[model samples]
Target chain A: MRLSKKGAAKPDPKEGADRTKDVLGGTEIRIAYKMGYVLNFYREPSFRKIEMELGITRPEIVTLIFLNFREGVTASEICEFSGHLKANISRGIIALEKKKLLRRDVDKNDNRRQRLYLTPAGRALYAKYIPALRERERAMLSCLSASERKLFEGLLDKLAEHVPHWTALDEL
Target chain B: MRLSKKGAAKPDPKEGADRTKDVLGGTEIRIAYKMGYVLNFYREPSFRKIEMELGITRPEIVTLIFLNFREGVTASEICEFSGHLKANISRGIIALEKKKLLRRDVDKNDNRRQRLYLTPAGRALYAKYIPALRERERAMLSCLSASERKLFEGLLDKLAEHVPHWTALDEL
Candidate 1:
């Protein structure tokens, strides 16, 4: 599609220096932007593939992939791992449940909690979709050396360690 | 602000792959994401400062900076150097013009082009903002050694050479 005319307004350029100082001028900031750009690019095309082939949005696919590894995981748990906020996960879960791709059950142990599990359909989707996801990842990362990948990941883990709330929010 | 309702949604679990691939994988992807995120964070905050105190976005700041270096530079050229598009450049010019931070005059050499130059107010803003921009940049690169920074930037340049549009769009 051509660019959206309504979205043409430039983003708000005014924000406070306090928030800016939080993540500014660090290895984390530089790496974050570069990766964010690539990820955005990577997602745009791959999402088109997911939408066309599986009838899923990019975010839903991410949630679905998580469900494959930890069945019956709580929404909170999902949020912690994914770095997405709870609402997004809830929306994806709702959409997936509607499609019969997964089911969300109340946690017997914790009434305030909900556990999510993939339905057979969800599993089938995973089986069919995982290779494409993997392929996209490999293509995007093809430029890195093994050693570089290790160092880069270690640095991210360091940064992730610092963002506890973001991590916590990744869980339901 | 308190977390938005959208922020309250459960997070996805499968962001591991993205995190792992981009960061731990030691590829340029991590750097790309970090740089994009931090630059955006920094730029937005600075722009906010400008709006509240000086009233201009980074794009306009970019125009000012480029114009200072080479008087009467065209919008297209500024857009190219700033890594923003023509539409963005146009919007920035409009904003700057409104603020009287800068002026655009028809290029005597090329009517299809407009040359940008900072007003005295713009020059003053540039003197103030440039140091902050550089400081933000220095802080972001702090995690790496000077040599590492060199290597990292070199690698980024190589990637840019390989994919001139890598930073331009979301099409991997």
Candidate 2:
């Protein structure tokens, strides 16, 4: 594995107990802390793969992911859903448009409303992207059983519903 | 809440069914997608807070988070557990040692080994860093119940242990 390529830098798993205790002592919440760490761990490879394969940056891929799932969405919906900045999403929209992978059309009822969708080419690229990325996901969870995976996915959605609060607590 | 301050960008709740099907059609996995989105959603504020409070970058804060939990670890162990690049971790160690927030000592049994630990000043910075950052975390998960939080944490650990494989499928 790329992560373990160099034997010198693998996690000293024996200290797992002390790591958990000392890190969790102050916050009383360990999940989110570890969540941040682990996601960062996976982020580089994901970026490397996506960039090499699709030639798009992280934000653009995120925007494409959103449009792939929800066709006819406005740029604003992407901002809300993906937590990307408006400026970044706009740039992504423009970049994809320049590549002819995505197109935006005005809503029939509202001239001001722009709807975004993947072009045929974009859809084709998305097709190529799926298997490679999903394989990584599958391998990552290969340790879990089908039932455990179910429980795990459900728990993820449960926490995901809180996306709205991610930034709002600053006000409080 | 910051996410809802402008009603226009909110993800339409009713689109859940269609969005799930459409998005997963390409990838067959939505949980990791959402996890990536939601985590990025919280990252900015956490970075902002840590930088303001502790004068550290995202990678630095991540290193500090690791050391906070497991003091007396080597830089390589940090790379293994935190998934940061060795070059980056080494740089972080140098920066922290320069700041006098962290100290490294040679192992008595192994003269070649240098172990890292937080200094009193580092502990003080962590004291300031916790409440501000954990608040964002609390807000991000305010939607979950106490029990759900427990399940969610356990599941995250399960998934996190799989970090090594996230990018290793190329060999498979």
Candidate 3:
């Protein structure tokens, strides 16, 4: 769809030619729009594929991926890292436990808290799902040359590294 | 929270030191994780502020932002652009119309279709809300040098422009 309505100022002919660029708006919101645009494609299609193939919900997939990397963590930690709601993550954990894909143990240090770990079945499921994610990422980045891809990765690394400093909104 | 469980292999000493990097995991999922991490901070905080101060829901805020650039579009177009569910966007449009922040007009080309436009009040509210979003984006990008920021934006633009080509996942 066209970003600018009829009779709106069109400063850039190139932008007008590219519908995607037009939909992204001007420089003020361009960064957010572009990032959101790319991320949407990444999440929406992948989530659909995962759900259809694996019969897992979005939050469950997130839990599986998180537990794949870091076991022995509380659901709260997964909620924090995944940006999912606590209730959703909790539900996901419960569902996974029921499916025998994950198991929980009482934290030795904190009896009230339960830590989550992936079962062997969970690991195998994650292994099955991961190659699709890898392939998706490869296709997404195929537009760039090898060096450009590396540069893009480095830039994303810097942004990710800087997240904690500005995540809190109390100052805003 | 630590990404790797205790006794997990630490292939990169530098990665071990940076909690964010660790949480992002290896190259296979690093890009998705990094993008999600940054986008989460962008959405979660800004959404909280918008909800608290303006009493707008996430979908409503998305509707406002999309209409700010492009008027006379259908809710379906907004859904497609924003990556939000159709139900949420419909609810947002109804809410915004009830608030007198947006108005609908019959599409001249198609009588069955109604087009959405921002009311003057809606535009004013969007105007008031945009600076904070702009500032948030600026703060997020402050980690990069001017040249690096330009390069990063270019990379994002490339990815955004390329989205339509690979967004469909029938082959996957």
Candidate 4:
């Protein structure tokens, strides 16, 4: 019921404001509000950068990511693993095939199903992007102490686990 | 350079199977990506709830939040603080005035400048929503240990402050 003084939640902005985040000077902070606000800021450039530089869109990369992690999966498996739209996954499969990053092979058991794999090229692309992706992650988390980072990441999973689904958010 | 075993990052899916969050039971994880994804899930319900039950749109509620945090600020200031568009701020301001949630008064020293404040009704509305909001936040973050929750909230601010602006994300 009490609104704390502004900026009481964290250290001085002068210390942390190196460049990426648009942190308001005054902060009557709410956990969910601030987190969602920040996610909006961070999402655009990463998604756009991957597209602009690699000529690969999010669904494409996401499909590749699933393939990289778990090969021998079919398009529907990718859909189940990633929850991407069926159409988007189909389009992504086609785009990745065109890029030669992935190859779609017909299932011997069922000709109707196409098993997907990260081609050597696609695997290379994933490896190449790892550094950049890791760096971005590092920068986003650089503010946390080593101990804080561990706890924060651990808690993130816990909170994420707490929600059975998005609809659960409305009830909460 | 290392991709850990599956489910190393987030909890196992069986633990948090929900309709909204498409929590991947995989090895790769990124702070910003996962957060943004969850935010997208949480955002729809809260926003839709406000709109359906209270008739306040997202932009309108967001504007009120900023005003609630930092009163006496101009519309342009809210835009700068939240990175919201000037047009959206103007529209929100008009909506709030119509709803009697806020009042605008011209600055005496600068006749051309108008300052905004929450009316008594607005403050009451804010108070009314506080419990529901706190409840939602608690549920979203309930998985954390008490100590972890403390560090998590603190780190959220630190990381948020890390970005001076969204463009800095491109550099990262």
On lDDT, the leading prediction is 3
Runs in model 3 deviating more than 4 A are: A1-17, A169-172, B1-17, B169-172
| Shift in Å, residue A51, candidate 1 | 4.4
What are the runs in model 2 whose C-alpha is more than 4 Å off?
A: A1-28, A41-43, A106-113, A165-172, B1-27, B52-54, B105-114, B162-172
Task: Categorize the docking of model 1.
Answer: incorrect
How well does candidate 3 score on lDDT at residue A16? 30
CA RMSD per model (angstroms): 10.8, 5.5, 6.2, 7.6
lDDT by residue (tens digit), candidate 4, A55-102: 887788778777776787787655544545578889988988998888
lDDT of 4 by residue, B130-150 (tens): 565566666666666787777
Give the per-residue Cα lDDT of candidate 2 at B61. Answer: 74
Give the interface RMSD of each candidate: 10.9, 5.6, 7.2, 6.9
Task: Look at candidate 3 and give me any clashing residue pairs.
Answer: none
Choose 3 or 4, whichever is better by DockQ.
3
Of 1 and 2, the candidate ahead on TM-score is: 2
State candidate 2's DockQ. 0.34
Give the chain B TM-score for each candidate: 0.65, 0.75, 0.83, 0.74
TM-score of each: 0.53, 0.76, 0.84, 0.63
Candidate 1, residue A124: how far the Cα is off, in Å: 3.9
TM-score of model number 4, chain B: 0.74
Candidates by DockQ, descending order: 3, 2, 4, 1
TM-score of 4: 0.63
- Find the candidate with the highest TM-score and give its number: 3
DockQ of each: 0.08, 0.34, 0.39, 0.28
Highest-scoring model, DockQ: 3
